[model samples]
Target: MRTSYFICGIYVLMDLASSDERSFRIYFDEFSIKYKVPDIFEKMDSTLVQLNNRSYINAEMILKRDVADLNVRAIMEFWKPKAQTNMKLYDVRVDGCNLLQSINKNKLFNFYVKSFKKHANVILKCPLKANFSYKMVDWFLDENDLPLFVPLGTFRTITEYFTQKRLAIRVLVHGKVLPKS
Candidate 1:
């Protein structure tokens, strides 16, 4: 079996692990934030950092007031050269409080948490305290723990957070999965 495949002349994707393409990796290409209630943000930033000879995203978000009654909706889309448009891969909306307490109900969400758990000090529960900093230090996708088969491509996630049904913040993350070579 082929170890990897070239698709649409756009990217090379590794075959399943049963093959010899075990060096496929995931990396963040960009991180961005949009504040709906700009005044509510005390500080928010995301940047790339090198640690242990690998790259990671260091992100932090701090609010000016205690945040509660939060809801979250996230959509993940993929861009394939052949499609010429984004294709929705997954979409989920959850009550922030419930999600923190019962992430196991959503395998995708649980997987996300696991990927960042090692390097993040972000609170897992709701009602984020005012002036308290939430952080992800030297956080990168844990390829070894991926729960789904991610094809090689440019992927984007739009994450929106709401308080009392009103949009408070938004996060846009771009990432890519490719052959390590």
Candidate 2:
């Protein structure tokens, strides 16, 4: 299992080795391909823009997955608010394979978030002690004590050899605010 984090996104790669069955590989990659920001101050600018009247901005994210050298197993678009807490997971997959269906009916994918005065922490709790956690971007607040822009964060989980072990790949992202006209 391998984990990588970048200013724009995160990527996780894993290789499953098996003695009887053929080897399987899985990957999870996500990045912010588009955004509008003028400069550093723009990220801190809490004012509502014409594109949206909300204090938070929407970033277009690219989610890609591959399994057993099969490209384009899944591609999706996900949007996240600048500020969030205690997100939930409704699905679990391994190399494009669904694991939630085989797991215990009572088990669930849990995600936790805690904010501090300076920075925030995101935690992904998986079954069988396969957990991932990371300290994310520092929160910027306005004079009114409201968030300006919470940085983007993402994580992925992959299971190797059926049940031999599980790997969790986590990433914390901070992107450059594009210049505004």
Candidate 3:
């Protein structure tokens, strides 16, 4: 069938693949996060990390946004890295608990320092908590220094590239939600 698509102008594209099992790809697109779930509808094979021989998956990723007061709660994803190629995401929750919890700013600062010490090559910035709320953690980073989030295409696209994996990170900055205009 022909599907209407628009990038700059309207165009028609052929749509194949049966409607049974499908996959959803999530990628960070500049300001907001974008998710694409193929039209194929049956059941989705939710695999967090599809690696080679080793496979490990996280249950879920929760993101709480408080736009009114520049604050956001990011509940980290929980995953157990198995052998080397077998990875799967068991649970997927966006708002759960803060895994990396530091008692106070001093502790958080120390934790950040230690993390950088371990991952020397990586550029990880110090995390800052929003003045309004503690749950909302924001990273202080300049525009030039930011990490790029790329999502691998679909099964067809996967073959073109390699397995979907987060490329090298440029810099780690805590993100803060700003009041909507």
Candidate 4:
């Protein structure tokens, strides 16, 4: 018996008989955050004037056996008072095949920051709510025919810092995934 192969544009061709499953470790290599104030009065407040915030986060996803888990670490720094808070996210599990299927079919995916630990000087009375959604704006195939996803999305976080003072931060996140070695 003989078999013929065809390469059409950027699509990758797969064989049904191949027992080898492609294992990919996707890295959330680059991410950025920008803070916004919805109210003009709040932006002009004197106490809030010193609120200069910056954040750096690194995250990665890997397949351990049949389960996929995500690990994320974030450091948020506040100026004026010179304080920083560290947060670590663990045990975030998702079906690896389902995630890839969603990306391939809809070009969109959603994930939750289900658990995290935070240490700060001032604590909030209510827990923060965070939602993350990613939409694939573009993608390309590598030399090995592995697809690299380039997604642009938004992250919204709501927290009550003080009595009757609620802060909502919407960050514009742009990220790319690279296959881990």
Candidate 5:
């Protein structure tokens, strides 16, 4: 058996060799999006759905204006059981176009690209045109992604999308890990 972990839109497999075989599995229960520039997006929709006994995140977004420069910043937070405060685990920003062009350079981003390659239809480079619709259907992370060790608990990842130097959209994904029996 294998377990997969997703953090900040990146999927990683928990394959640490240990004497104990028990491990936890992560699953998403909710997803939401916030538009800083409400009018800049022609359409934005994200929802968690169940299909054929499997969970998938369906999302679609259409831009109302063209974009020449693109950047992304992701912040991940982890919380203990019944904990009132959460701790920030990672926070980094990168050029979206460059990252997409050289997806293999960054191990984490490469996992994201691998997942997106199967489930998402969006721009891979710059010069995004207006009224172009992009979507991710039946998206779920599995063992074929990256490798990361995430303990049993809850986590939240907030990803912000930017056009030029201005903030455009924000994505909030919440999930938790439960012991597999």
Candidate 6:
């Protein structure tokens, strides 16, 4: 028997070794890819930006870093009294290391925003590919949460991260299993 699995917006292929010879099997929930965005982007002026949607990330080296232990800094942009902008910097330790899984699902969004607010004053650099500029700052949890900051009216560039699609999975058994030694 052979089985394939997909979880959390990632395509995962799982093959069962026949040596076990266990007839029974088990499966988990339907996996998905979901995350939070900073409240700043909610503003009308902070239009949706696409990061690496059309083009691929081309780089010689991809570095990894931890977000919890980074020195961060943010610059405040004052335009309108009602609508202000803040550009904070964060240093991600590891890139492409399943950031979504790092945070506990119940408090995932809250944890990220809190991290931004706490570390809003340090020059943070990207841990992954440098050319791939589009990155996530914070995830908003409640309606009361407002924009911490916004960027200038004209953004130099924008990147759209895409949602991973769920692929069809089918499992079948070729033959029955016999007792093991």
TM-score of each: 0.78, 0.15, 0.16, 0.23, 0.76, 0.18
Residue pairs clashing, model 1: none
Once superposed on the true structure, which residue ranges of model 1 sit more than 4 Å away at CA? Answer: 1-21, 50-54, 147-149
> Candidate 3's C-alpha lDDT?
0.23
How good is model 5 by TM-score? 0.76
Query: Superposing all C-alpha atoms, what RMSD in Å does each candidate have to the true structure?
Result: 9.0, 21.4, 21.6, 18.0, 8.4, 22.6
Name the best candidate (by TM-score). Answer: 1
Give the Å shift of residue 168 in candidate 4: 3.8
Candidate 4: lDDT of 37? 30
Relative to the true structure, candidate 6 has a C-alpha RMSD (angstroms) of 22.6
Model 4's number of clashes is: 0
**Lowest lDDT 10-residue stretch of candidate 2:** 40-49
Residues 75-116, candidate 3: write the lDDT tens digits: 222222232342231222211112223313344234434433
For model 3, the stretches where C-alpha displacement exceeds 4 angstroms are 1-68, 83-181
lDDT per residue as tens, model 5, 101-120 = 88888986676678888997
lDDT to native, each model: 0.77, 0.25, 0.23, 0.26, 0.75, 0.25
Q: What is the lDDT of residue 56 in candidate 3?
A: 26
* Candidate 4, 22-64: lDDT as tens digits: 3433223233333233431122110111111212342221111
Q: Tens digits of per-residue lDDT for model 6 on 139-162?
A: 112211323222223111111222
Clashes of 1: 0
Q: Per-residue lDDT for 24 in model 1?
A: 60
